[model samples]
Target chain A: DAGVTQSPTHLIKTRGQQVTLRCSPKSGHDTVSWYQQALGQGPQFIFQYYEEEERQRGNFPDRFSGHQFPNYSSELNVNALLLGDSALYLCASSLRTGDLMGTEAFFGQGTRLTVV
Target chain B: DQQVKQNSPSLSVQEGRISILNCDYTNSMFDYFLWYKKYPAEGPTFLISISSIKDKNEDGRFTVFLNKSAKHLSLHIVPSQPGDSAVYFCAASVAGKSTFGDGTTLTVKP
Candidate 1:
């Protein structure tokens, strides 16, 4: 089965500009989550999308937003990007079982965003 | 605050030796813990995990031990191989969110 996939393996953006990263969840998965991995740091949770609505979020600014399409694909948008926004953006997909999150998640290679 | 912390930034071991990576968490509510390994330019791949209800979980040569009382967990790789050299991440999950550690870079020398 095809695993989770992300677009634009690498990107470069300018400050005060906007950028959108895309993600296609693994087949048979329903939930999509985004994470940011800064240099020499672990992946930090950004937010999660389920049922086409944002279900959970982490300690991120309002400028970070995302959308989940009906096909289970997702897009993460960052407005007014800052140099600190430069990091590896990863997309993870899992299947929701009842009220609990999937026990294991499959991740994509991630998109490396560099803000200049 | 970092809910999950892997204090050791890097570890090195001789081939065929045991490799233990430690992780500590500050959140008591976290019940599920997992370990992931990542190569350069690649996303982390899930390795093994343990639930709060159990203290140990093993798969083949990989094992994970959880100590709920201490809010600590560890991943053990027996007879490590050179190919195992990579960054290992520890994560704790509650609800639908997961918090990850800074990762430990492991180098297995042949």
Candidate 2:
């Protein structure tokens, strides 16, 4: 079985531009979440998607948005990127049980985003 | 305010020694805690977790201890190996959302 997979291993974007990162969850998983890991810091929760709808969100602003497709894949879009947006974007997949989130998650290698 | 805090930025230990990474959280509602390890250029991999109901959980050389009253948690690696050297992160979850610490870089010297 394949683990979580992300696209465009690395990317470079200019300020004020937009970028979209993609992720395919592990097989038999129904929930996907996105995180941002800045240099020398731990991954920060961006948001989580379940059942094709956003289920939970972190402290991120409105500029950061995400979508979950019917197939359980997800896309994270950041608009008006700033220099601080440069970081490693990680995607994690888990199997949600009832009303509780999965305790353990499988992560992808992540897409390194550089805002120039 | 940062909910989860790993005060130690890095830790060094000799092989076969014990390695302990500490973490504290400001949120009292968090009910679940976990530890994850990451290598360079790779996303963090889940190591172990303990619910609020349990004070300790062990898996092989890795053990996680939670102190709900203090809002603190720790990861212990016994007889550490060189390969175990990596960034260890402490995460806390509540209401389906999880928060992570800055991570502690552990170096096990052989």
Candidate 3:
């Protein structure tokens, strides 16, 4: 079975430009989350989407936004990208249980974004 | 403030030995802890997890131990193999919002 899938394995964007990364969650999954992994560091949570609406967010700024489609796919948009925005954009999917008990997250290969 | 911290940036263990990676957190609200393994040019894969109510959970050769009072968790791999070498990340969550630590790279030598 195809796990979480992301598009445009690698991308290059200039400063101040905007970019959108896409993700299709694994079959039977309802929640999608985005994360940024900088060089030599672990991933930083960007935000999470559930039922076509943003359910939770991390410490990211307004420039970072996301949308969850009815099919449970997701898009992560970063506006006015800076050089620091260059990192690996990871997409993870999971089954959301009401208790927020933290179920296992299945991740995609990730889209590497390079901001010049 | 960085809530989750992996003090050891890297570790090297001989094959067939036990490899233990440690993590600490400062947030009291974090009740769930997970360990993820990442290879180069790939997203992290969930290795194991432990809830606050449980101090230990084992899956085959992999085990996760949680210490709520200490706000710490650890992942142990027995009989480490070369293929087990990778970057390991420790993550803590509260209400499904997770905070990841700077990963620890493990190298298993044959």
Candidate 4:
């Protein structure tokens, strides 16, 4: 089965500008979660979407938002980007139906966003 | 505050030796733990996971040990190889969200 996929493998955005990154969940998975990884840091949870609605969110600012479509695809939009926004944006997918243990997450290749 | 932590920023071990990566979590409610390996300019990949009920889990030469009482976990790789070098991340899930550690860079010298 095809694994999680992310588009625009690389992108450069200017300060005060907005950028939108896309992701497609793995086949047979419904839940989509977004994460940000800065240089030499671990991935931090941005938010999660289920049933086409946001189910959970992290401590990120309001400038960061996302949307999940009926097809289980998702998009992350960051407005008024700052140089610190330059990092790897990751998308993870998991099946939420089975037991908690079975709902293991699978990550996409990730989109490298560089805010200039 | 960071809930999960990997104190060692980097580690180096000779090939064929054992490489141990350590992690600690401050959240007591975390019930699930996982380790992921990441390459340069790539996303982190799932390496292995351990549940709170089990103290240890092994798959091939890689094994994961969890000490709930200590709120610590470790990933051990036997006969470490050059290909095994990467940035290792530790994560914990208490409910709907999972928290990650800063990550450790493990290098297996060939």
iRMSD per prediction, in order: 1.0, 1.0, 0.9, 1.8
User: What Cα-based lDDT does every candidate model obtain?
Assistant: 0.95, 0.94, 0.93, 0.91
Question: Which runs in model 2 stand beyond 4 Å of their true positions?
Answer: none
**Model-by-model DockQ, in order:** 0.80, 0.78, 0.83, 0.63
- In terms of TM-score, which candidate is stronger, 3 or 4? 3
In model 3, what lDDT does residue B25 have?
Answer: 95
lDDT tens per residue, model 2, A10-94: 9999999999999999999999999999999889999999999998999899999999999999999999999999999999999
Give the DockQ of candidate 1. Answer: 0.80
Query: What is the per-residue lDDT of model 4 for residues B1-110, given as tens digits with 9 covering 90 to 100?
Result: 88999999999999999999999998998888999998886778888988888999998989999998899999999989999999999999866588999999999998
Candidate 3 per-residue lDDT, tens place, B47-103, comes to 998888999999998999988888888999998999999999999988878889999
Judging by lDDT against the true structure, name the best candidate: 1
lDDT of 3 by residue, A47-93 (tens): 99999998889999999999999999999999999999999999999
Per-residue lDDT tens digits for candidate 1, residues A16-50, read 99999999999999999999999999999999999
Worst 10 residues of 1 chain A by lDDT: A97-106
TM-score of each: 0.98, 0.98, 0.98, 0.95
User: Residue A105 deviation, candidate 2, in Å?
Assistant: 1.1
Error of 2 at B13 (Å): 0.6
